[model samples]
Target: MPLCRLAGAGALTLLLLSSTVYAQSSTATGVSRAANPALSANVLYLVGKATRHDALDEPDERHAADADEHGAESPGARVQEFELRMTSFVDPHVKADLTLATHGVSETELEEAFVTTVGLPSNLALKAGKFLGSFGKHNPLHTHRYPFIERPMAHETLFGEEGLNEVGAEVSWLAPTDWYTEIVAGVYNGDNPALFSGEAEEDVAFLGRVRSLVDLNDATTFEVGASGLTGRHEELSARSNVVGADATLKWLPLEAQRHKALTLQIEYLRGDVGGATRHGGQVVARVRVTRRWWVQGSGDWLAGDDPTVRRVRGLIAYVPTEFQALRLQYGATFSGDEDTDHRVALQYNFTIGSHPAHAY
Candidate 1:
């Protein structure tokens, strides 16, 4: 995305982000405004990826013919990629987000197109369109929020590349609390697994969390939550019911009883299910190595009988300013069947347009 988009969407994201320096100006007539409301809304995004599969580990019996995460089976295949996302808001509480990209980094087809945000009341916010699912907090967060460039494999596998979005409605609320606590739940059609994620069904889904980290006095704070989806598809359906839970702890070394500053952190996630049961947990560590440099590492262990999936990646990122970032990383996988492959990638991101402020 472009710098122009970042500045525009900054406000759209305001409710989702920790308070910023720009917040201000309340009227007795009953309305609030930013000291600087925002100029024009615009967006531009670009990304490319190149990967080599020296050996995609394939166990003796795990069908190589089955389309996997990459949707490929042949060896020595190299994958390249591209993406562009742009959105603009006409009103403070309403906006449109559109994403266009290739199926393996090429112009094979359109990737994502969705519209979001219509604030109704203290406990109601609505979204309707085809986009990424918000099952886990991480699924809906932007690329900028993450300490590393890539999301954990657990996320990639469960949500797929698009992060599990479909034609649906989502509702969120601010629960009464001394600290920040949020509840978000959604209902939609499962994609067509054979071609898409499946189709909509008779069932609905829910994801809820009790959080308090925003502006907390404690340098270290915590959160615990659960997310699950269960739907029954009629005849000839490939429905996979799921249920899960997650917990996080942020141990910021530097305390600022009064401010927002860089902090080192670690987090973990675990989930239990019937279809993809014992999907496992992950460990993440991140550090702001310098004013302009950041380092992060993450590891995962799959718990099911499946061996084709285990992953770890290390990353280094550069932040010239808050609006943009450049990153490089090394990703390795232990798919029980495919080779323990390795990958190298480059990513450049510019936050665009008025959208929302939730971080990854």
Candidate 2:
């Protein structure tokens, strides 16, 4: 069968199966609808134009890794991403979530499939399966949830398009402190081509993170986090280490929490791969102008082994409801001595079914 037809058929089958289960569970007297998992789908569509048609095809190492990840660089309209998610509690003590994703007619991929423990002793939790690691704020976010049309140049260059997703087991602890604090650690099979390759049986990756949150006042809050990861390199047959730090400050007036707010976030990352070092960071600011309007801006910078790269972006968004949004964004990039490149994008996002709220 043709690839497009096969993908369509699979999607239809999944929809039908979920509908059938929902109907049966709802009508059956002894069956509890709550026993069924909650299902949701999110779709993103983008129309874009760029000054440099071959920017992604550039021979520069900085742009090579981003060739296949972003549809915005192609100068056309496309379904940027389609995602289907299912979440449910397996029992009183455990919860499971699965997310399947596809990009612009590409084959479906398992974005995340993990099970987490609910109530463990000493305020501890355990999670196992394929998941996005808690490396930095941006690495774990889904594309649909991104504040901008595309990821930062630093993240794209460091973690590839998908970020640090891997099959692993993680444990987290809620520390006893006056302020909110959490520590997380994990182990994974070193398989991500960008950072690691599990060629040998002993090749594995380790991750650690610490996060803390504090309320600055009645309407403001501050959060800080640090993350580190170590793994085996593929070509060099040696070990690599990546470290990151992030900070965020949010201000929301008690009287106008929904209509007015401001958020500032910053993150920096450094990696030592085979004795070579690269470092980068991004700063973003978002402001809520009204109940249904938002404006945001960000700056990204990277330096070290690769040529220095810098980008500035701005966006305006209209969110009529929680389920749908429309946005327009513009960006300019300067890489080393190359001519500046400019791009513009319009995006529409929508969701259906019972989706859970995003994390703070």
Candidate 3:
């Protein structure tokens, strides 16, 4: 059978199974008013000044022609985004989460709407619906949680603006042995514009990841992971494959101390598009300077058929409370022989209502 048909059948099966589980769990545990989904919302605002110069010797076009540079333009002030999130447990065996986002006054988008199994047998769990792919450390994070004003070069060029969000389902298992370890696999409707562009539901994508964590000591910790995704690239009528690895090291002064901490994170991604290959990654370090102040820096690099690009960024932030933060960032990028692009951005974020903990 065609891939689209297979995808459609799989989706229907999962939906029906989830419904049955939900009904059974609900009967096992009586529902209460608290069972109703909880609501929370956040908004992020950004103002920035930026200038881009093409390669000094290259022909000057009105705009730098790069497919990966799709994002809020420079040299302006705009409402970056507003997000509304809802979550709650459906029963003893399932929970649901939904996220909605609006940019400026544009049409609102359903960022995520997924149902996750809660009390599955063994250490297994399943999640299904419109959701983000578990392809990398960065793919599943919401924009408001981003430490930087914009996504890294590698994520943008490789996965597109939204970072692998699609209609999909994921199954994960906690390994029986060792320190924190998990294996996850997922299937998705191949709908991403940058890498996958299948028109029919039969078009499908597959992803897998293995993650592990170790506590080196009371004050330090380490984590590492690898991920892969493959699918039909409808745009080129070819296959696209992406593989990535990531690591993180962290230190804290004490178990209860949240103010004094340092963390370093790195990730590398490589993609095969048709017969060509492209690769890149980013390294970021963050330190808390004081109770309300923090500083961060990151470096990004991309190598491929297109001009190689490197970006460096420095940021300083004041987070008075968990509910609000103000940040100032400066970044510069050099692409091959092209003139360097510079940007200075100021961002503000605020939230209302109770927010849930993010995935680990």
User: Where in model 2 is the C-alpha error above 4 Å?
Assistant: 1-34, 54-72, 198-200
Q: For candidate 1, report its TM-score.
A: 0.64
Poorest 10 consecutive residues by lDDT, candidate 3 = 55-64
Candidate 2's TM-score: 0.87
lDDT of 1 at 131: 63
TM-score versus the correct structure, for each prediction = 0.64, 0.87, 0.84
Report how far off residue 193 is in candidate 1 (Å).
Answer: 2.5
Error of 3 at 200 (Å): 2.2
Model 3: lDDT of residue 52: 67
The candidate scoring highest on TM-score is 2
Among these predictions, the greatest lDDT belongs to 2
Candidate 3 lDDT, 51-105, residue by residue in tens? 8633211111222353214335535677789999998887878899999998665
Candidate 1 lDDT, tens digit per residue, 1-360? 699898789866875553443343354334554333333221223242325443332221222343354434333322333345665674787777666654343334344556567778786667777666666556665444555555565554445444556666767777777777777777666562311335544444444434334544456666656666655443344345544455556554564321333443333344333334445546666666666777777776555556536678788877786556677777787766655667765666655444444432
- lDDT agreement of model 2 with the native: 0.85
Q: What lDDT would each prediction earn against the true structure?
A: 0.53, 0.85, 0.83
Q: What would the per-residue lDDT of candidate 2 be over residues 1-360, giving only the tens digit for each residue?
A: 699999999999999988887677546547675578999999999898888765432323554545556543576889989999999999899999999998776757999999999989999999999998989899989888998988776677567656788888999999999999999999998777667743456678999999999999999999999999999897787788999999999999999977998999999999877787888889999999999999999998878876888889999999998899999999898888888889888999999999568666
Which clashing pairs does model 2 show? none
